[model samples]
Target: MQMSWHRRMLAAATVAAALSISALWVAPAQPSARNGTYFYMVMYRGGRASGPVESEMTLTCFPEGGNHPDPGGACMALREVGGDFGRLKIAHADCTMEYSPVTIKVLGKWRDQRIKFIRIYPNRCLVAAMSDWVLNFP
Candidate 1:
């Protein structure tokens, strides 16, 4: 059957609209229970003459309700990347934190270790766990 270009375009547009609406109506993926801000330190081996270098990272999380005014209430996730560490995933629940043994590839050879919501301040949070990385958003 031969459909006019206008008809085809209309069909495509309808499908697109339906997909968009479905996406809007569908609930967001349930964030891990362990969520909040966290700080992490990473150490890398240095050359014979140089000592091991240490890097600092922070992770923070926000719950469905929104940002927690207190650091203890904030939520976040963390992951590690590159080198021998591979990729590590971590999350924070309340005051405690949890980690994932599995690692994933990110960018080139650099693997990342992720840590979420370890609690830094009251209501404030840290999101990413990469050295010097800070969480500015609420």
Candidate 2:
């Protein structure tokens, strides 16, 4: 006896549905994509102890959040300067002028533009004074 055309079509549809469901279940899950700006901040010493020191983090802004511990404060600081690191101003406080030699690097994308910022500060105290606690890599 031959299988009816209607029965064959129904069987094919059922198999297709099953395959589709199984494919959904078998495929690996993925992490949600991050939108807005992404930044990498690093602070390190120079000379004999030329290695990472103090702090380091991944900072995200605009939508405002990231792997950084103080995301809210960092994001707010960035916003205050219109995302321009150079424009960040120090608060009214005294800071020592001693020389220690530390380097800071901020590499990332912001507002669809690539950012590469590197600066050498005399010490952590000077870095804190100059950066207004923005970037939060300290």
Per-model lDDT: 0.33, 0.72
TM-score of 2: 0.63
* TM-score for all models, in order of appearance: 0.26, 0.63
lDDT for 7 (candidate 1): 100
Clashes of each: 41, 0
Query: Which model scores highest in TM-score?
Result: 2
Over 4 Å off, model 1: 33-65, 70-138
Residues 78-106 of candidate 1 have per-residue lDDT tens digits of 23232222133433434324331111111
Candidate 2 Cα outliers beyond 4 Å, as residue runs: 1-34, 47-54
**lDDT, candidate 1, at 71:** 28
